[model samples]
Target: MRKVWVGILMFWAGLAQAEEVVIAALGDSLTQGFGLTQAEGFVPQLETWIQSRDASVRLINAGVSGDTTAGGLARVAWTLQPEVDGLIVALGGNDLLRGIDPNEVRKNMEGIMRAAQTAQVPVLLIGMQASNNFGTEYKADFDRVFPELAKSYDAAFLPSFFAGLSDGEGPQDPAALRQWFQADGIHPNADGVSLIVEAVGPKLEGLIAKIDAVGE
Candidate 1:
């Protein structure tokens, strides 16, 4: 009886130790792996990277192609299920591309963040910058939106998630960013998405660590 009880206790302990950390990757085509297949997308690569470090993470890819901030807002409750422990929000690219009002984008993002906070999920806001060709005023408005939203929401901020990528400048001779894009000239290739996962890994780890520490 003693030996059987010990074995049962050990089984429970192992199960507890193997609990998964659920993470949600929510955004646009970039999150959906636009240029490449789903397996090669950012979230899959990120999940692989996370598992390499800690094998218990489950990263959910909630990306929607052609999804705008409004769409993300609409689907937040359903998409961000209760299992979500952390959220990586990579949005607003389509908003800027569509020339949507910066204020509207801000409002939508704020609403999303509010919902995340209410759910007690940690958030990491991925930022994007508009093309200078959009004019200085428009670029400024779009560029400033992310930082402000990050600050207001008290979320981790990644300034210009594709900071090194070029808008045009020729894909072959892509302004030092050729290596990070697929043939599409817009969406990140598998290699490019891998780079992003690598760049953001440390930040994500830090946030996870902090959360774990608080529970201790």
Candidate 2:
């Protein structure tokens, strides 16, 4: 009876550990939790959101401030380590800010996706849009890179990382959006991080489901 009970305990423990998923969040300062407390940053907040949904998951922050898609591509191999079960690719903001060529961004993103594919890890591609200041043609081209790549790679897609922050009635009103950002007006504040987490949480859950389905 004692040996049987020990075996049952070990099995349950293994099952619990199996439920814990390790997700690597690969991106820019936003993923790094810039301008926010460590506990309030994107990774931590995202983890909290995941736990709230009763999912056992962990997020590894591989974000570098001002990193472009090329940068992300360069680090894909190392970031997607042996224990990494999935990836969250949230790059391209710096590429947009620097007005880098959309085709180049697309290629770089494709490379990153391919790297993830080779590792047999699922990906969640988070997209960003170019501001109007970059002009209509640039905006259109930049906007298409994400969804196109996501479709081609069969990755999960989050159209805009900052989707729920505005109601569309006053997008241009900095005052209305001010509360969502820090003084730099670029990286989100803690409140903004919460909103972003809420918006992306469901999609993340879907990605987790994919990972579980694949037995990763």
Candidate 3:
């Protein structure tokens, strides 16, 4: 009957809506796509990357230019909206740049992780390595903050936001790696973002899988 067909159509539509997965990327300028255009930034490239694999997902960009781990901690709760089913935490770059102590960065990052945990949202945490200029002890301590936190929470982890840029032969000079970065020698260029997305996209796909573990 016509009435039975209409009811079935609406039921299917509601089923489709319930399966949608929304994720939030919480970070600093890198996540904010700081020098890049609307389409060329990290979130857009990442979204394109995921959809190409036939996954349905939406990403919320919660990146703030010049924001530090402390700032991320402050804003994480609101970023985890009711619709957000997953998260990508990529803060601490600005904190490293400012020479903030690793302990403080770790504490702030832990706070963000706790907020996500409380919200019952899955997370994919990406981190940045410290420059040697920050000194041996500082570098070691800063480098450990991210992985340690990820381990504590059992969240997915990527050691560096720039993981795709490395040649993997060995350490390369910053001057040598300039092709991938903007003129500021800080934020990555569009081409650089492309490489990063290719490498980093898979890990986030895993997060999506975790969030959808219940169904669809």
Q: Report the number of clashing residue pairs per model.
A: 0, 0, 0
The local distance difference test score of model 3 is 0.88
- Can you write out model 1's per-residue Cα lDDT over 123-155, one digit (the tens) per residue? 888887777667889889988888898888778
Q: Find the number of clashing residue pairs for candidate 1.
A: 0
In candidate 1, which residue pairs get closer than 3 Å at backbone N, Cα or C atoms, i.e. clash? none
Candidate 1 deviant stretches above 4 angstroms? 1-10, 164-173, 213-216
Residues 148-180, model 3: lDDT tens digits? 999999898888898888865212577877999
Q: Which stretches of candidate 3 lie over 4 Å from their true place?
A: 1-6, 169-171, 214-216
Q: After superposition, how far is residue 147 of candidate 2 from its true place, in Å?
A: 0.7
The most accurate candidate by TM-score is 3
RMSD of 1: 3.5
Question: lDDT (0-100) at residue 86 of candidate 1?
Answer: 82
RMSD of 3: 1.9
Q: Identify the superior model by TM-score, candidate 1 or candidate 3.
A: 3
What stretches of model 2 exceed 4 Å from their correct place? 1-10, 168-173
For model 3 the local lDDT of residue 216 reads 47
